[model samples]
Target: MSDAPVRTLLLWCPDWPVLAAEIVDGVPATGPVAVLHANRVVACSERARAEGVRRGLRKREAQGRCPQLTVVDYDPGRDARAFEPVVAAVEELVAGVEVVRPGACALTARGPSRYFGGEEAAAERIVEHVAQACVVESQVGIADGVFAAGLAARTGRIVPPGETPEFLAGLPVEALGRPALADLLRRLGVRSLGDFAALPAGDVLARFGFDGALAHRLAAGRDHRPLAVRQPPADLTVTAEYDEPIDRVDAAAFAARALAEQLHDRLAGHGLACTRLGIEAVTAHGQELHRVWRHDGLLTAAAIADRVRWQLDGWLTGSSRRGGGGPARPTSGIIRLRLVPDGVIAQAGLQAGLWGETGEERERAHRALSRVQGILGPEAVLTAVLGGGRSPADEVRLVPWGDERLPARPGPPPLPVARDTTAAGGGEVADGRAAGRRRGGGSASSGAAGAGRGGAAPPWPGRLPPPAPAVVLPSPLAATVHDADGEPVVVSARLAVSAAPARLTVGTAPPTEIVGWTGPWPVDERWWAPAEARRRARFQVSLADGAALLLAVEAGRWLVEAIYD
Candidate 1:
């Protein structure tokens, strides 16, 4: 094999992600539209760009730029599904196409150019054919290597033989597609590929390391990485046959998830990760439906399942496709499903976190939860979310598991702490006229802003300090607090206690002696609404048996509110 760079032809699709949304999801592409991932814009349409929308802008900023923008989540599967027909069209014109991503593909220019008379002729022919066959516009560029060709395709330019370095020199370093590297280089005043290419190769290797060295080689038009992708092993395929055809989308989704997991597990056993997958389904009437979905990154089990579900949805509902799978509806319900790993590579850059962010144990737990959800409905599992509130019940909200855990109400800003001089924190309450007075200061806010999405630490005034109660009573247990005289301890209208609490009693439990006590810390809520107003004096007390309880007096009735662990 020649060591020189191979002449490569790259076909590019502009705004392919936005177009894919329209094709697969039926979101209109003509209007201002943006695709976002993790709240950042990944791609946008021309109309959105006209309105000042740009990649990397936050969703809110993007929407602000174009109020009428149709926002869609980034779906790699949709891009792949929609681009499949375009690949098929190109395959019809030439042999051996390597998908660089959902939006672009590459092939050797030698064969196509020689067969079509010249590079220019081959490029024009491919573009025209793709447009005619797939009804999608595309551009073609011929250059010394895949990287150069990919950049060239942006403007439909062909870099002359041995001139790729000159062609790439003026382009910005961002064209290398390494954001961190580009940012670092820009900080170092190396703004263009030419500047980076001029750096000493040894120094580049030493400073930026192996990946950086590879990027350096590309900047200098030395992308010798061959187009010799390995074919996935046949044993990596997984299949399932059902006696009862899956007619409903939910049933199909459940089946898809199982099959996807099997396929992923098989691939994992081989120490591999799939970048592209082929989904095959057989209908009850013997109709066979096959489609390939591509992803820019390794496909996780959930991602594979999602693609399978989407494909099955399209087939079952006869969704129209501009290309690829077309609008062909299966004649009957699907009775069998199969997953083929079309493209895979040695697993890299993925391992359990050093601090246990992810591991086999976590994966097992996730799978178990997902299975439970499938059987019991998505809402079956619940998780507690902690937010701003005065009491335990008010602070906690139960949400369906896996949903974002955000506080229902933003917490108030942290208040300055003022310690009481007479008591443990607040002066001990006693029956009879209080001997000491305690004014509780603002409890320190755990998060100044109550753990808002932005991580602001605004404090909640008078928020209880932590060492939170281990168990908050579902319903406050009826209780009584008494003094040394065995009389009910009363809290006056002015928060004055009848006497120091000496004993505590809960429903059916004998009186227990109070070892220590603090507070007639008053809580008044909804003062503005008479119908909803509530007043309570709360106390934290330790019992003779070494137990602690949170007690409150409301409407002259004592209740055990919570127990400390």
Candidate 2:
């Protein structure tokens, strides 16, 4: 709310997730690697990027594109813990360092700029300091506000005083960091920050609400909120003293969850959310460990607990050597754990619906899923998402339940509904068939068929029409399609069936009479790869039991690929 914009400098480390994982897990930096959250790429190394891997791609797609790519599960706590040393190094050069997240931090530029001769010099000094201390590549940028400064850091530019608006104007609206809003703006012909900034403020507020107004202010190079920095109340810290020394990661995790909930409850009572947290632990040997985590957005209870666990893992399992060697396990067990709410912001109260059900069920479901994740591993509970692909199997993606669900990309042309072979011209199949096909391809019962690798790439010219099967076999079941005389039925290269109107036998089952059958649809997949090439013809056959089956012929053999239940 201050009339004068605050001059801020932001330092950013590129590919922080990959860097953190490599540092903690000893992964080779030169190797192709990616960090995935909810089965979508969150970050990838340069080698992986060169191989066509990018953020937002599903895990299977990334692997398919780069066979050598190593995948690491996303751990925000690891990212934050790894980044702590970098923040400390920067703090040594400049005071009031405000971490934006694991990979980035911002601070008021006035003091550092004056001391180092200029904004650019201060930035260079901080970057150099971080590189020396953490051995990670970093960039620095200075602008009128945190939003503009963060954007500037991405390009390592310094915006002159009062010129932040002009600098922001040319950038794409995506700089706002709100994907949905940016996408909607692009569709509305508001392609750049300038275009968005030109919209009437009231209209933006009416259309997009509080989040939109915040983005609008940022796009215009104005601070969304006043730069009022306040210290968290001393009593807000949550501490747990263990009677028995706890050395294992699981034990620390158990303690972290309870403490995180306690901290969350206290903050909620005051209508507040933590933006920055400090984690502290004391070992039985009297050695102390401390780390700070910052978030650009509010931190929920789960997020706080995750950070605590990560910090404890680093402290307990990390190497004792401070001279840039491999991490060593701790010498003693942790005796105490504490969480400090270093920074907090007002959280608006939720408005209840007329029925008073305002998201209670969702919260309960989230808690239940979190509990399940705790009981099992993070990957045990998953949620399926739809994404771009040709086959019903390819279009579905699975991510851990509590993680952010990657937005589904545009898939191949919609599939055709299954119709009875008796119906004239094949009426559209039931909607349930489409949903079933999507779910069935990867459901638990289907085994690895729905494991995210069966989808055909887009623009598949010879793809079969949908009314996709309700149940897809993970692997085709060998079967025999026989003509009336009991001779084998074959499909020609021209896709003509040598003989139809026959009997079907699956895996030694009794022969069943075929009622009606459709044309064999030919598919030539991966023709470019000789060893992996597949040329097949598929048919939809109606049987005597009032069931439909999808049959595929490959290498002169018939197989049962799926069934319509």
Candidate 3:
């Protein structure tokens, strides 16, 4: 919307993956071919295009256009995998290039233009470098802005500054991105860009909104949009296809090493470092071999390759294979190998410590421990902290170190707990303070010993207490028991109010009087169950006999079930 001028470059590759596939693996550059999805067309080869086959056309329609056309599904994953090296190659030529998709990338012309003597030369250098790395032909276009550059790339036409509007005036109105605008133009008898541009801006804005005006701007080639920037060492992956299947361990290792170099180059170009790598090998019959290799620090290309080879060799020697002869082993023939870096962080070199001395030592120790833990089960190592909860069982929770960040427990807050069981008296800390003061000169350990052996005492209000022994019945029961006044009490409904007599019993335990009680807590949970088998209310009560419990009576009998901690 501003009057400021902007510069951009558009790069595109026609049938990029197919072409890259041919160049990299030396496949035949055959006849009319199309990249398809199931039976729909996504992109067409030049031969297919010459025969009038277009993108988004049905496979049958495309075939109708060129009866001899060969169709292949659009494999975006494969395409992206193949294009990694190309992006890396381009990165070597320009500092801030944006990838438009699987194949094309856009780079600002300012830096490259000045360095290479102009936009044209910059584009030429990019194409040349990219072609060499990816082993494929590429096209580049530079213009005033992103829209114009994109348009230029599609047509392989470069437009110099200040000539965009004039150039666009002759294009069809449909080029503006509003199919509806084309219909409108047709209705209004506007056929060309010049005719559309001749209309007043106010009229277009009022009828069509900003999109209509944007179409007008694009048509006029007045591109002023800035390039979107992306920061990296982004995670990088590399995959390679072999001319012949390789089954032998040494040959497979060689292939993996080559792929690693390419991957290493790509990652380095992005200024990224990775700690984990995964290698995948695909067999002739579509069988895939997957291996995950990890390292403590930045992985070198050769090291990654070695790990892949080792894993593949091990698997091939161990697993049984079908067909002629005896035990199966890696053959000398391999078709493809893909290596991917997993543990990616936006940092360079070894990750640093927070401050100075203590931080450095602490971080180093953590890293070492993490490496060891990664090899073992993640659950095998853990840290525990005091959590704010009503019961002792809920007070302390174990958390995985690397994968989890222990959240600050909510509400009444935590009781004091220890970091390690060996610390002081094995007490858990709440916030930064310890729980429960000890009397006299008793050591913290001595106090814990006494507390642990004596079981837990009653907890005060707002404080977490040791777990209580109580049974939760799945359903309510109907039982008669003697009240404090020695009278028969019959149970009905759900939760008993404080005034209700103790009338439920399980096993040989005598019915106890309710010393404390809370809530009917009505539950309609089983509304979806059988109509007659639903509905109940729950109650929490402490008896005069020192038994605290959750009980429910339904369907006539009390069932002793879950012990609420």
Candidate 4:
């Protein structure tokens, strides 16, 4: 909406995670390496990429692509800590350096460009300073706004004044970084920034909401939002010293949760929320480990604890994975751990809803979950989230109860799956709704125990339609499906059914009459991998007793994979 776009400069360090690990662990830069999060590749070195490794590939797949690749779990704190020196170096040249994230930062270009003679010169100076300060590679870009600057930085470009829009017109819509929105645009034939920016602003707002409008502004080479940079307060650090060294992750995490709560309470008293945190630890042998973590928004108590846990997991386990023989285990144990609030912002007070539960109830739930985490470990207490996937299992993502839940990846909507009350082992049958009442007593207990456990995998293209089975067995149960003539039923590779199913026998249960049946829905999984290829046909049948079952035929054998009660 402004007559003149804000002049912004961005500095980005590619593969910062892998580089940070290399810096911290003394790993050579030439070797193929990747940084993983949730067992998926988040970043990889140029060497690794050249070897066919890519972001989002599973760890095994990445390794399969680059057999000698070094894998490291992503540690935001570590990346941030390692980048502080780079930020300090840049600040020496520019007065205000706002870190966009751990690996990137942005600053107003007007002052620096004039001082350094030109925008291109300023960029060169920043890159030189960072490289000399940390021995890491960095790229710089100058454009009309932060969004364009960030994309330009990826290509190390400098857009002349008033040319930002024209410069960005040809780039892919993905430059906006909103995957779902970008995917939608692509499907609508708006594949480039020019295509997107050409649409009516009101129409974009009416259809895509706030996020889409913001992306549209970015594509048009306009600033999406204003920046509010704040200086972190000194002396806002909390530390814990152990009388007896704590060597295990569980113990360290428990201590982290307590400290995190204290830190949050302290910040709340000052009406502040931390946006960036620095975690430091001292091992018994006197080895010091430090890392910084940055968040786009305020960090909650649980989020802080989760970062602490991740940092410890990386430091404690990372040593063993360092090349040239594992670094000697931390001589003794961790003697001290400290958390520093590196960046803070004022947060508006949260008003309780008139009809909704009060803040006290939320706090109580938080405390209960924290206690469980302390007892059973962080992964044991999880919250379920629906994400992009075809099957119920693929759609369900379970993150630690206290941690942030990210948006699901962009993809087609999942087919509706029927909810089975007895799926976990209790629910009504068609003939008698009360049939599961007696079994319902233990259902809650069983469900609680499996709260974070995921459901069926991503929907296989030819998988069964929703109204998914109430219960999916961990392992298929052996069964037999026969035709009315008492002969075994068969489905050919071409998917022709030999005969209609008439009888079903599961495990040691007596054969039951099939009242109805549907499907020979076939799936050919991993057909390209000879060793792992699977060809199967599935059928859903209703038994005379009002029980429903999902049966699969693989290699001429019938197996009961799920039941609907």
Candidate 4: TM-score?
A: 0.52
The window of 10 residues in a row where model 4 has the poorest summed lDDT is 436-445
TM-score for all predictions? 0.52, 0.47, 0.47, 0.52
Error of 3 at 505 (Å): 37
- Note the residue pairs that clash in candidate 2: 1-226, 319-327, 319-328, 394-455, 417-429, 418-429, 418-467, 442-450
lDDT, candidates in the order shown: 0.78, 0.75, 0.60, 0.74
At residue 479, what lDDT does model 1 achieve? 95
Compose the digit string of candidate 3's lDDT tens values, residues 1-565: 6644477787787788566546455435467888778678877778888999887799889999899887666677777777777777877778887777877778788899999998888888888887777667778877777776766787777788777667677778776666778988889899888887777878887887988887766666655466675554544778788778876768867776888788877878877766777768777767776655555456667666666666565545434432333324444445778888877544365754456333546546655554444333345467765544333334456866544345345324222432212222222222212113321222222222123222243222223223333343444344443445665433445333323434445456676555443322333333556865444433344455545454443444333323343
Q: Which regions in candidate 3 have their CA more than 4 angstroms from the true location?
A: 17-29, 37-40, 177-180, 232-276, 279-290, 293-340, 343-565
Q: Comparing candidate 3 with candidate 4, which one achieves the higher TM-score?
A: 4
Q: Write the residue-wise lDDT of candidate 1 on 273-378 in tens digits.
A: 9977888999999999887665545789997898788777767764333243445666789998999898898888445456554555665665565444433433
Once model 3 is optimally superposed onto the true structure by TM-score, how far is the C-alpha of residue 454 displaced, in angstroms? 62
Of candidates 4 and 2, the better by TM-score: 4
Write the residue-wise lDDT of candidate 2 on 377-440 in tens digits: 3465887776654344655678876455674665554544444433321332233331211111
Clashes of each: 17, 8, 26, 9
Per-residue lDDT tens digits for candidate 4, residues 435-504, read 2111111212132111223445332345345555576677889999888899998877666777767889
Clash count, predicted structure 3: 26
